[model samples]
Target: MQTAVGVFGGEGYKDGIEVPPLMVANAGQSDRPEISSLNCPPFVAVELCREHLGVHPCDRRRSINEYRSLFPAIDFSLIENDDDVLWKADTREKNEEVAARGLKFLSWLWTRKEKEIAIVTHSGFLYHTLSAFGSDCHPSVKDEICKHFANCELRSVVIIDRSMMGSDPATTNYPGKIPSGLDLPSDVADEKLPDEGKVN
Candidate 1:
């Protein structure tokens, strides 16, 4: 069965890592399914999707400006901030707020029967969304999921149904339930992550 997998870009990717050629080749499949993102680095993911999957994103944004020569056939959206709020905000609640916007997009995508779908965004946003895929999740479990993803890493799941997703999607930052050693949203607010590295 064809699987839709999200590919994180290697912008600030640690060790100068790049998306695997095999993954890029897989994304270049003949089906040409729609790719999606939160309007920033996901455009980098879009480029990956087109370069690897042979599909174009459903909505386009200008984040892929650097790839004009490589992905000449791709048409980018002129819409400003179409994929906003995923990581731009400072507070956990604000972050969750934008993530909910992303969740809404995914829940809508789940309605389609297209065997696979891919989303590309920064590690932090990706971690939050992945954790939200489970029910009654423990903070440790969420922490574990958040810690595992690295730049250009591709993680896939068989979402028979979005069992973990709610009618109204929200982020699981647990701002009010902070663990003892974890950094608070404010503490990490100004932290600038390289597009190519693991968030942790």
Candidate 2:
């Protein structure tokens, strides 16, 4: 989302504010160009979706490489990649697949017990995530959640319950399906916050 990016220390930021740079979570390829232009360091998460899932589009790999070149001083290997979720959502089935991967990936993050994380991913995948897990919310709220979020715009989604997963079988990735002891709540609510916040 461009608005999210702007407030998160991307281009067009107001002067006089010394916002600490946020670590770019090397995720979806769709946002790579925007993230690369953010002028921030990157954390190449192994769980991040590769360019085109290592599939079509020859330029995909080239594009990612260009972004990688922007951060030569950083050691991307320092951060271990996890094989949780990494796929693009092109069709309905593809959406489900990527959404499942996202749930697994997010579950893994919750297992880490980290206080916070900032993820810059494609809008389609993100929509699948909400549609799958956020079924309990009012339709209006759900529509509102999806309606917002322009490219490079930043949004903070608070996962209030780390214990339960959504009731929707389509969205739920039970613990048995993943690594031991990692379970995510099935039902989730988006705690809307103003775009302004500390850079992740």
Candidate 3:
């Protein structure tokens, strides 16, 4: 995740990168103060995101924050208050619940008017969350990005339903789902990129 963000722009990075400032799409938005808080090993997605984000305590060179910290990048504002972790995963959580949360997140992004953004995430969880947006991919960009993102790879995508993005998405405000009978379509998903044709 950090690697993905770093590629856009970070300390020690040369100026004139393509993307805009990065925002992390954490696998599980748990704000645990220590690894012990996680109890078991930091699950696959958690571990990988920490590794690249420079927040993992085990790897000093890679770690920037203490543990499970996303400072100097993802501000506290983006996260939910208290221990109500945004994307925290739970064993008892139902797939429908997960899908609802994922859809709400997409809607939140839409509310923020985020056209293009960066996501710091791992494979399994990526699919797990994105799959909820809809069963299928948006036809136009699907071919370009394919099914999933490869290791530390980059791709661009567009939202299909444009409604799924409604914190709980506006679409839910009224009706028996879209006319298609599917939740608004969205892609698994970038950081801030400089305005094109502009010379820095």
Candidate 4:
């Protein structure tokens, strides 16, 4: 049995928003403090970004390191860059390709040893991935997930003794289940980028 936790990045500034380099550099720093609280080992952290965004796995690591530097009290290895997985694709195909990739990533995680794992991906991947688990997906669920994603959301779906719990049985929610509003720090600002051109 393992626990799967999904965290979506917060609202980023719009293009031409004129954010300082320091601001852009400091974007994901807040997540580090929050992520350090998890009691999991051999942690599997997945960073899901859109291919068009120009973000890379190295950028994700920098954010992770920033968090670690701020909170050295947290005891857990990052499993190195090799252990980190980056899933990049078009957001337009979020309902199909992105969701499929998210599911495939989760399935692959299940095959590994049972341990607590964390996935940090885009909101589109999170929403659609949970939707694909069922024959019919609901609009309300999508709305709910979208609202959560609007902020820096962190959801958890626990697999209990081989049985998945917390996921929407109706296939309403993506990434299996959507947890309650994440208990993130108040200081953490929303850092999501604006939805410009769709992923082509």
Number of the top candidate by lDDT? 2
Q: Which 10-residue span in candidate 2 carries the lowest summed lDDT?
A: 181-190
Ranking by TM-score: 2, 3, 1, 4
Comparison by lDDT, 1 against 2, better one: 2
Q: Candidate 1: TM-score?
A: 0.38
RMSD of each: 16.3, 12.5, 14.8, 16.6
lDDT of model 3, residue 184: 27
Q: Which segments of candidate 4 are over 4 A away from where they belong?
A: 1-40, 47-95, 136-148, 158-200
Deviation in Å, model 1, residue 16 alpha carbon: 36
Structural similarity to truth (TM-score) of each candidate: 0.38, 0.47, 0.41, 0.37
Model 2 C-alpha lDDT versus the unseen true structure: 0.44
lDDT of 3 by residue, 1-200 (tens): 34443454343333454322233334226432211111111111222222211223322222324223543343334332333332223334454554465555555555544455655655534554555443243443334433666887665545554344443343223333444433222322211223433577
What stretches of model 2 exceed 4 Å from their correct place? 1-46, 49-59, 62-68, 73-75, 78-93, 164-200
Q: CA lDDT of 58 in candidate 4?
A: 30
C-alpha positional error of residue 174 in candidate 3 after TM-score superposition, expressed in Å: 20
Error of 4 at 119 (Å): 2.6
Query: In model 3, how large is the Cα lDDT of residue 151?
Result: 84
